[model samples]
Target: MLIPGTHYRLAFTQSVLALLQVINAPTHYRLDYPDLSLILALVRGGSLARASALLKVDVSTVFRAVRRLEAALGQQLFEKSGAGYLPTTLAQTLAEQAERAEQALEAARIGAEQGGEVISGTVRLTCTDSVLQSLLLPALARFMPSYPALTIELCTSNDFANLSRRDADIALRLTRTPPEHLVGRRLADISYRVCASAAYVQSVDSHDLAALTWIAPDDFLPDHPTVAWRRQQLPGVTPSYRCNSMLSVTELVRAGLGVAALPDFLIGDGLQPLTEPLHGYDTALWLLTRPDCRALRSVVTLFDELGLALKLP
Candidate 1:
């Protein structure tokens, strides 16, 4: 026969034992374990089917992962409606924490790998195709030997590269004024000048500028600075061809198609430069970076090298 006080104590001890059992659950019972990486991948992918496609996993696998997560937390983390599942408050909190952890892990990896004094990491440089063909490639050939540690990623697109989003670290541009947020060097006062092949000159009678057909690029519209200048300077000049690429235009002119505007550098490679001016046209070429980013060791070194090598006073 136990006393009433002893019986109370025994009951209390059992209650505490039950609470401890719940608190110290096995690793398999914890939802916030290593499998949360999959949960985060789903959060980014937005839809189950999309997440499955992105992860290259079956839809059922993703469903099971989420189900296991919900069970571990003992909560309904998503509300499935006619329009697909929406995350509950608990899921949102988990997603935020997961994102932070993912970013931290990435930063840790970068820091670990690049712990030395060497300046390294990938740097993307954007420029026009023509510029790349004429200038960047040769420059890079020379540039590579010195800084073997640094890698150059050359991306050529006619459309502007957004420096704010890190689309490119440095850009070679033909704009007179760079965007307000960007710092740039005036690489050169790039001017477009009209020229024709020696054969075209012989056939068309180079003296008659208005009579000869003008060769132009498709995107160089009449309203463009170059076209506008030509129209104002050489009125009633009809174009013989409008090709998309500068290389194409060069080829057409090479075959005596008609007179075309050639960049100075492109003319250096045996195409022949025209001494006479056809139309008054001029524009500046720029190399720019986000002002905040110029301090980066890689950006600064590239900027200085390109400006000094290319931009002639």
Candidate 2:
């Protein structure tokens, strides 16, 4: 005996009332995407300072956001112990949900960016100078022009970029153990050899390791394998030239300043190996990206491309 469309009207009224109840609910807070993202950052970083760095905000801002979120929810989310901000169970759950939302949004953004025929968006890459000069730049030069809309920012440094902070989208690193948080594949084995200019190699008695003028990494890199090798293997030998950077050491050796240990990739045409691959100095080169960033087209493309291009023996 209901009127025509009466059921539809009732359903619409019920839907509106439910929405109103949610809006009026005492537990409701004006939570936005950024607020949810902040929670995830806090949980991941475990401290105001770390969260600040991750979000590119100040510590004070993170602190205030935590306070605001706590006040809005009427529950404690984090415990400020001496170590750092430890997330409570509620905070952890919320962060997990937020992470899912973040992933969805990121996927949508990436889709929009790649909606066109050409893959678009910027990818930031970080690596050492030797890797940059020898491998990355050349590979990029050949293929990057295909994606004219895509931008690549290369940051060359020996130091590790803070992947947690999103300082770089991708990192090519030479390390025995890559960070646990980063997900990547080992591209190749990095081997070091005692190298010098061809002329210098011919001039010096390569077998008489002690008599050759040595170039060593300076105290800036106290733990450089070359430093330890020189100290342990050639105890009485003092370096005639000490350079702070591996790139500098490579250049000096190339310029015929003295014999120095260099990565096999860095020893180009003019250089000759005085010794075979140093046994204990070997490390694997890794192509790494944050788990969250690996899904982006640009990062994925470059990472796969580099992995293929630099699959050295």
Candidate 3:
């Protein structure tokens, strides 16, 4: 039976791999040029519009190019999601090798321009700092224990990591959709819940919404769209304090600053989930990488670990 969302080349690869097994070739099958680049682009941009925009081509031109590529190879690269496209499983497998191949191609380009060459070397990776304390650090602890020979240069911050320019091997963020060129995953649907410490709840006696104190994220001001949205849902509520770090927000909430919208993963042990809504808000967490950097054994290992670490019970 044919699966609806599978990449088109998988059939060919399966046959090729089976044949290769009989002949016992010590290698893997890989895609050729432009098709590789095209697939990478679509995956990274997350939408046809973004891909076309970034490439400085008309959307129609990109559509035609993709059709041509698909015809030549007889592969359907992407499957439609509500308004975007996700790579098929075969696309994912191809992505693993394509990412490395793209890197080698980049090296060739570098060598051509500089009239020089260099050996392959390891790269550093950076991502959200909270993931370090909540998800990443623990995942690494488990991952590192097994891959003892692997050396990782890790940095964690909320800011973007530029993989195209090789700033990091991978990154994670709470965004709806990532750019097309990166081969990545939407690891989880991160949800936010307003929470407070037992001591703080005891202090607030007001049953009325108007009198309740609140804790807000630094970016959430009275006029901000997100804050405004929350306010519509939480009428008469106002923040008592604002903090940037999730850790700091948790600390303030514990110190009786007020109720804050915090991820379940970010809150401390034994805190009660606030039944009241925090101006109703939610955001997704994304795992990102340059398309050319997907599925390096190191990346695969780490990605899987991080996914497991971030999964909600």
Q: Which prediction has the highest lDDT against the true structure?
A: 2
Candidate 2: segments with Cα more than 4 A from true spot: 1-116
For model 2, name the residue pairs that clash: none
Better of 2 and 3 by lDDT: 2
Q: What is the C-alpha lDDT of each candidate?
A: 0.66, 0.78, 0.63
Task: Estimate TM-scores for all models.
Answer: 0.59, 0.61, 0.53
- The collision pairs in model 1 are none
Q: Write the per-residue lDDT of candidate 1 for residues 100-173, one digit (tens) a residue.
A: 54444444445556674444445789987778887777777776665545567788765564576789888887
Worst 10 residues of 2 by lDDT: 14-23
Off by over 4 Å in 1: 1-116, 220-224, 274-280
**lDDT of each residue in 34-109, candidate 3, tens digit only:** 4556666777787889878766778888788877755655567678889697887766655555555555544544
* Clash count for each candidate, listed in order shown: 0, 0, 11
Tell me the lDDT of model 1 at 224.
42
User: Compared with the true structure, what per-residue lDDT tens digits does model 2 show for residues 17-66?
Assistant: 33233333377765555666788899999889989999999999999988
Provide the lDDT at 238 for model 3: 65
Per-prediction CA RMSD (Å): 13.0, 11.2, 16.3
